[model samples]
Target: MFFFLSSLPELFVTVNRQPRGRICFSFLWVEGGRRGPCNPTAFAMEQLSTANTRFALDLFHTLNEKNPTGNIFISPISISSALAMVFLGTRGTTAAQVSKAFYFNTVEEIHSRFQSLNADINKRGAPYILKLANRLYGEKTYNFLPEFLASTQKMYGAELTSVDFQHASEDARKVINEWVKGQTEGKIPELLVTGVVDNMTKLVLVNAIYFKGNWQEKFMKEATADASFRLNKKDTKTVKMMYQKKKFPYGYIQDLKCRVLELPYQGEELSMVILLPDDIEDESTGLKKMEEQLTLEKLHEWTKRENLALIEVNVHLPRFKLEESYNLNSHLAHLGVEDLFNSKADLSGMSGARDLFISKIVHKSFVEVNEEGTEAAAATAGIATFCMLMPEENFRADHPFIFFIRHNPSTNILFLGRLSSP
Candidate 1:
């Protein structure tokens, strides 16, 4: 019943619904220039899936703890793809650390899964527009190996382009930003700032995702009204609240003490799952507690078919929008991704010589939720910087809460956000 927006640029800023149901783990692969069905039940696939979920949960806890009082929004997929590209060039412990931190299996496995997932999501042919794009802008003089470029094009669908970063860095930045803007439908205009790319810059890896979807059971525009949103026990602000009452997939996690509601988009291939805490007096406390117990297993169990009961519920969700930007260098270092950013980094896979290292990873996100649907955009520029759920019944998101837009088939969390003020 609302719009969601997200974006991630160095200092850049910018810019779903359904029902029925969908299952997960069935993917499609392209081989011999033909598409074929592939099951996500293999050992490697399971390992990657579990690892990615765990990584998402771990990163979420960090973000939740880092910005306890403010709103937060991030595109893990975009960040992951950006880093995955860098990981392809890493060796020894550098690659191992990234693989461990991000829950990627082998480099081969990582690219293949992303390839299949990207293809499946984009080809759903549903009433939604979802796009994930990647680009690599390296210094025109850098000798990038052919093998690296081939792997990127085959697995990640990314083409490495030569950009003159040694001189005219600003122009290079502008070109990259323009490409990002075009990929994201102008939702994210400025991804890299003036100083983000300088003479010392070697390679810049970028990833962008844009999604727009309509609700299966759209909220009536006439039902929106000005309502008091509880910022905290002692503070309040007026917000435009959207109302909808209908049968929805709903669950209450007793252990976490929160309500979980799943609002499906038109095609039922994706959904926005909201976790509204039980107590609104102190919004931060409930969210903090949930973070303590949040895990991949718990998320899966809580949203399982048996746990969510169909019920006629009254929903009061605010018509809110958020645009957030983050510099993830320190945050990622704290998450065991240290080697890639420092001089000791080994990124020889991109070039035959080990002369490349990540300088910074800048991200920005935007989300808008309204009576119609959700619109979200996120851009991540590795300026060589490298960088969940619930169900329903009487969900009243009048205070701070956490939300995510997920691909139901792959169980991939595309965009995650926190609504603090709105």
Candidate 2:
């Protein structure tokens, strides 16, 4: 219900479902953190952000290979947070692979920094509404370690609830799914399907986060019209192209020939940065050039404070909504988290026995962009021939492009995906 999760130094209860507005998804299921200062450097939250970005890109590359011509979306932080809850109960190679995959050096950095940053983000009355939650549902008969339970509860604000996973699998699934749906504002309807948990299910880990914010500068409806989007060199589709002409932060990468533009959310607390590549002979492969040069370092360099200049830009972005789910089993195994799912695993920290291991990882996320947040604002586009007055740039996403939503204050990426067909 209305729990005042860890924000003000006065409290330390796990995340509260601070329900507010419209939806953007972040729900996770893991069949699978400590404490330190609130430092934001390579030692603390910054490292976690770095790890999150690194894993985000890695996962993006994997998803791209799997669905080369489809739109993909995910919340790495949501997945990582859910995994962190499970990380509390991991040992040996299980923890090693997780550490390596996330790029965190040690247990201290992962849990301590995660705890610090989580508190900073969960600050109450924030400009935008954000709800992140995690819970552990274990079979009432299962025997988990007291230390693991206490650590997760204190550091991650997660609580382990007793559920009849052995006898009432469907009921347990519904309860977990309902919690996820509520936390995600219904953007994610269900997190656990019929076959995910059953009589032998001993534990289920879940996490969900929701975010909704209005644009600092509105894209007027009158400026929007049906425009042809080049899905690739061959296919094309009609899309609602939202338009806006405003002075915003913009950058360009000479090597990749991609333009980066930041469309800030209301109050400028968060911004959506778009990476639109210049149309080449093979328009379909334009994004590949950008992706080839894409890295956490390059991304930071391209969007850094000094690299971007505020200029008047004519923005033509397609109105799009994306809801995606991933079964991350094969993906993680390929990423070096091998032992977590198979018989050669070790999760003894959970119960002083190696009997427990993760069976699957399910991730779901959703997002929608339009004229504004929930209401439409009107603006007229400026038209002029010669740039003798003022130079202007054009950011036309009539084709595929990559985008990321960043929490400005922390510089932590909230969401990352590409609109290939939108």
Candidate 3:
């Protein structure tokens, strides 16, 4: 959820949910086309995906550093897409900051190519339901530039709906929230909190999305049993360990001394990649070493297709769920993106004047992992180990590990998080 409730020209927001058990999130405030250079051979989606993933890792590091020992789950696609929409209606420093914050500047013709990328990501007929939605709202009296409106609508597929925020802020909030709730299939009933919309509100932009995580080779519930998950060298917690053994794309990064496992979803178009480090008995040999080397270049080198090989693996994963919310104003400021949220902002692209600025940005996310997966999992409960010297195939996530959901084709990361204490 990325909420854009500003005390300025307009409000922007969005929500996300997945299938079966859904991911519920809403942004009360509102919300890339581009091929990047540097790698001229790459497609626009590839370049944008690189930028998105780079931002995802940066945001993950920031959040993890803020709360090192807690569970984290956020939709990088949701946040990045939402912010890109908002930045669509901005120019000058406001645009520069947003571009810099997300590394969109590296991409050429970012808005148009981003539209293509977003549209491709949301295409129907996938094995599971995962979609990104966009819409716009404005105060009945406020006048917005046709250029901004047309650009946002064409680029993000957002259709503007006029609401009387000046006279009926409460009613407007309820309407917007209900719309978001309906869009999320009632997953988020209250997207716009009471005080988020008031007399000063002039416009709003909202987005919604749905996602599903169905494993291509799911864990067996029968094989799953309570196991000890080490919080660190000194502390451990009991967790239901999901067990599975099958051939998957696996790799070993000697530099970080970690094993990477790619677990595809039902369609094989999306996957969850896990990074598990060797456990150390003494000292805090946690994810610090792994995190230290997590640069975009290194990540690309580590996860590239050529670097991995299909191999049989004994996978032991903990079934966990996480919900995280963050006010991105401070974090964006730390990234030198403070203009959009403060009075010094310039968003003349939206209203043809300098009356608009993003006041607040709140993001909330939820996700769960269990033994359940695609319908095929029930039929084959493949349950099972590895020896040293040969190719390593035993993957044990008994301690803290890093994982991210990735769109296979474009290499865009959908979600990035870690199980610190789970």
TM-score of 1: 0.85
Deviation in Å, model 1, residue 361 alpha carbon: 1.0
RMSD of each: 10.6, 9.2, 8.2
Candidate whose lDDT is highest: 3
Tens digit per residue, CA lDDT, model 2, 304-369: 656678889999999988766666777777788787666555667766776655555555566788
Q: Can you give the TM-score per candidate against the true fold?
A: 0.85, 0.85, 0.85
Q: Go through the candidates in order and give the clash count of each.
A: 45, 2, 21
lDDT of each: 0.66, 0.64, 0.67
Candidate 2 weakest lDDT stretch, 10 residues: 1-10
Q: Which pairs clash in model 2? A: 14-157, 33-111
- Model 1, CA-based lDDT: 0.66
lDDT, residue 66, model 2: 86
Judged by whole-model lDDT over C-alpha atoms, candidate 3 comes out at: 0.67
lDDT of 3 by residue, 94-164 (tens): 78988998988977777886687668767888886566676776778767798888988899888888878
1-422: candidate 1 lDDT, tens digit per residue = 00112343122210000121100000000001212356333444445446656676777778766778788888766666666666677887788888878878533377777777667656856789887766666678756689988887787777778878677779887987788778777877766656655665566666667788898789999999999988877788999999999888887776567888899888887789898887864445357766666677777776655567777789999998888876666777788988766556666776665555555555678778888898887611111110023233568888888888877766677777778898
